[model samples]
Target: MSNVLRIALVDPSDGSREALKGKLLGMDTIWLEADCSRYEFFPDVIEQTAPDVGVITLDSNPEKAIELIQRLATSAPDTAILAASEQTDGQLILRTMRAGAREFLTLPLSSDDLDEALRRVSQMKFGSADAGGRSCEVYAIAGATGGVGSTSTAVNLGCVLASEPQNSVALLDLDLALGDADVFLDSIPDYTLADVVQNISRLDIQLLKRSLTKHSSGLYLLPRPVELQDTLSITDDSIRKVIGLLKASFTHLIIDLSKTYSSVDMAAIESATRVVLVTQLDLPCLRNVVRLMMGFEEIDDLHNKVEIVVNRAGLETGQISLKKAKETLGREIFALLPNDYRTMVEVRNNGVPLIVQAPKAAITQGIRELAEKLEKGSSPAAEAGEEPAKASESKWKKFWPGVKQ
Candidate 1:
């Protein structure tokens, strides 16, 4: 790969655009390959030119500018984005940086400053640092009831996702009963969720990373309170702060939530980009899934994000059929797993996840496929206000025999 930095710029204003263009054109080492008036043209520009560094102006269009910056960061992780703006206020600079801009420049467009910023951008492209632009997607996992394998699913999913050498995953145990995630991961940590909440106002990416326990597979675990009493000190505000901080540090955040819908649990769920509601096929678990789905229906933002998963679905002892279970819930089953008691028990006793211990097991195969779909950005869950599929209803009725939708 050539060491020369290829660049692109986006500025809506003609005067500022020309000024930036003039400065960038004269640079010796840096080549400016693309420039445009609107931020909308960035992805095409990025694709066509494959710029190592991108400069997008942030001014009156802070909303649009920030959105584009995030899109570019996600769409082209290798590109280092710099947000140039006339407003250099501390708050604006922080917002721009948080939105995934690698460098923020307050503008009258100084050549020396531009050179320095480009130097840092070039370093990012080739450096040992995380090239993901600090972007993350939070997937919240909540079981309908205990022993439904919420922790197993969350921790194993985290491990599977982390198996990708480029992926950085964080697993947060929010059960607040001093969750069993540490036990599941066989992790003995120096810090827990309570410690983060105690110093939440001071928690940043580095500090938060320090508090988490890193597994051998590269998954980071933030254990819940060690003492049951300490769980009382965890508040919703603290959970929100910690989750936000983690989102900035990791590429994928997997949260294991307890059955109780406490404020802290709700905070994580509301913050999640996808909610994985894990349930068994029994009456209680099925009922709980329906109840939770109905409750989620009341919230606009959350209703559409629910991904219903039926764990232990194909066991000979399972009470409900997969088709019938989805019929009872009246939604598509996002994913299903066979009952693998022997493997699950052995792994739990060994304190390791299936992906690491039994990668070829049928259960591991199912979870791995689930991980692939999530990593591929596809969810088979139904949306709010979406009528149950006509085909689904017909098949469901046949599956149920006596039950009516």
Candidate 2:
């Protein structure tokens, strides 16, 4: 296998098909050669091109594209699937991810996104060889339902984890539209995850870092789109590309999962090291979590990795007790957070992570506890502190628990 990243662009739309292919060709460093012939039928196209990366810009027959992705995952396990966006829908995004799409690209492409996507593909090819596949963790943070503090929890947890001096973390705000991760952190990012999707063919570490907005706290944030009209859709190839890019740069990655079950959310969850389901003391949230946990259990390899996080845990609400909640779900409560209105209001007004503004508060304390739990639950980092200089063992040795190679 040569270093050149072979790419196949499959799309029925003439404009998107030509535009995407042309953009990849124009990039000088990315050795991307496209076989656009896959636009006819993705399955047939994959058979003929057998590219390392496959790009699907299908707007008319999305189901067909999904079918092709599912078929290709088994037929060609090495080929990465990328999907171009015409619009953004939570269900569509999740469905695509579960169907085997790696990433999604929103319309009105950006040069940075294209550049980064290509770099991601190249890295994925090499990283797989370095290990058995790739060295990364996928952390999924999903709301039990809407307005249960999932976005806030995801953002703060990621920010706190990223704040550790020696550890690098990437916080991905996966809620395509109406995602408030930027607002929560009070950051004015130049780019969002949507940019990464549109330019899935040219992603690299340098480009990925450039796309990020680094906080003084040392956290790398990939924000969501500020504009309500902007679309974000990615394919398996693009998701893999972006995830691979993040993995190379950061030791820990925390993903803010979209509340709605769509192709995008599923893709993010599959790539996550752990899935954190954030719930509140309410029937709606608990019921939703119950349903979602059941749904996750149906998927292979996901049931064991899913963790239920009870946010705003202690309240005078008519809900199941903590023990009963765990009994009902048949899983342990990963963590419990107290409901603190004063701190939440203050942090919301300041537009900063609660951990930064209220370190000693109940919620913040719980978050810190959760962070430490995650750090310990993993390998080498647990034996040593979070600092790399303090590591007594090799990084590879630390990774022995999950390292297959």
Candidate 3:
């Protein structure tokens, strides 16, 4: 019994129960103490066997199954509960977690996923100190407006972070409609975010690693769905679940969000350890930055996490100065990415990141500096009581002559 994980199983479907039992029996570390076909009798079995873990399948009667989990959580606090269901709905996963499930498995479970879940249970029961206390740093990168090079910054930063031997990085493209993080890496991933969400219930480290496309630079990427309609199925809750799983598996998670401030993007932003708001020195971009900052101010502590980055700085002689841009935003500029149109174009066309294409280029060096700043855990030092520039209709109308104000 030393180093063995004892499991009690309950599945209303006899076929599913048999299949799960067969899988469990195959694992050398698992000990199948007792098996039951009904939820009502599972408690009695648990009482008799006193199994270290309880496995419950919820497809037959989810409500009853969840009730059993809740009961076991309180009554058998020593026993870890593992829930299984065919449903991949994010709400169901959230409910299952809240009901005190130590792990959740999707139907027709991947053997690897099941093994990983059991390993987690083993650690929980036996106290594996080596596998404890790992945390992932998530950085959500958003463009102030279209064509502001937000995705470029995210890809390059992820690449640089992945280059460090200490970091295991994953770059998630949240720009569902038009994400090209995979394109930037020159990777045609067999799996995408749609696939991950479809199998969100069984998403363990093994499944997740297999689903992502690993790049030559060592950064793992979960690209957007290939089809436009697939994006419709992706919900905010699903995005949160994905982020949670990614945070658990990787040392660093980089999310490149769409310019549209949708609920999904906001969910990612809220989950992120830091929000890198990439912008430029132009009037339109600056205006959007002001609007976005104002919106961030409304959310609790979101404004503090925002770090404004200026891309393509000094492209034009008439471009806004860094000092003026900071004064306009009422916050310090987090970084100034040098304007290198030729190098960026080459990298984009070649389907490679800046660090790999031209490591010595000024723009590549700028990206490295940005990554260094982030690695050092430096955040924007927003002035006390400072307010972002108000998007006054009068101020903008003067520039465009719309004359609405």
Candidate 4:
């Protein structure tokens, strides 16, 4: 078999189609057999040319583009289908994959990522060994209440994880409308979570990696939508799909969830391998923890995944004790982060992570230890068969009358 790929291309956008054609023509391993500007004419072009691959761009008229893919998939069984789009939305990708597109490419493509996708096609056509699947550890970090330092904890933890050798970590700011994770990291992303969701259909590993803004700490971040209105389009299912895709590309996905406990937040929590609930030694925070724990218990053994961490520990001399805090939640405290106002203020102000700004600081060391403990998978709740906090049950009932024991 000749190594060169004979290609038939279809793209409705004239400019993008020409740009793609130019790229294909430049490749020594690809021969452009035919090109069509319309989806209606693509099948005829493919039939006449009998190219090794049929490249279809889906942005101009997605419904029709998808129809063309479906028709070509059935009518031309031997021709491998390659779907291209500017959008990377997960639903579109799933649909294209289901419609029998062997490879999906994102437009304004990177030469390297394009080459890699083509190489996969080559492997598939000529029968070569495919890459093995990888598993991802997802940690969802939520605050017991607003200002409990969940985002701070998540950012630092993600930085620590990224610092580890051979660890590819992504921090997804799922706080949607109100997330400030980008501000914490001092990253001004060209793309946000909204872009990823809108383009999810074409989202492959390459596209996902490109959509994120990489922090100096070696962690990739997907911040919440830049506009508040954009958050309305971000649904629970979309969050789940985004997480699923992120897992395929990264070793760890750290999610910073909003305190609203909305469906979107719950979806993230549901997908997490560990839910780190960050709180302070205060009545309001502890009460929120108890309420959240009660809700978590209802989800299939999810209580076992909960790990409570007290932030701002010893910030005040009269603050509640750790022992009483644990008793209130009916679970052991996973870790305690020391209060280091001066260092944290500087770290946040400078948009630098704790590990980088003050590696020797007590809070930094505390976060590093927390990362180690998480890696060891030593959750006290998981180890002991403890029921939901009966002590806080009455308080929970007062807040949520419909909830039963």
The best candidate by lDDT is: 3
Stretches of model 3 off by over 4 angstroms after superposition: 1-131, 382-405
True-structure RMSD, every candidate: 12.4, 16.9, 11.5, 12.1
TM accuracy, model 2:
0.60
Off by over 4 Å in 1: 1-134, 381-405
Give the range where candidate 3 is weakest over 10 consecutive residues by summed lDDT: 393-402
Regions of model 4 farther than 4 Å from truth:
1-134, 385-405
Cα lDDT for residue 272, candidate 3: 87
Ten contiguous residues with the weakest lDDT in model 4? 126-135
TM-scores for every predicted model: 0.66, 0.60, 0.67, 0.66
Q: What's the ranking of the predictions by lDDT, best on top?
A: 3, 4, 1, 2
lDDT tens digits, residue span 1-405, model 2 = 123455777777677777776676544233343455454466676676567788776585887777877888788888888776777888888888888877777665678776566566666776643222223455788888888888878778877887776567788887877787777778899988778878767664556689999876677789876666555365555665676557655677888877777876787787777788889766677667766755664566665566778888787767668876765654567788788878887887788787679888989988888778766554332243443321233222222335333
Model 4, span 98-156: residue lDDT tens: 99898889988778877887777777776663322124778999999998889999999
Of candidates 4 and 1, the better by lDDT: 4
lDDT of 1 by residue, 127-156 (tens): 733332234778999999998998899999
Model 2 poorest 10 in a row by lDDT: 389-398
lDDT of 1 at 96: 81
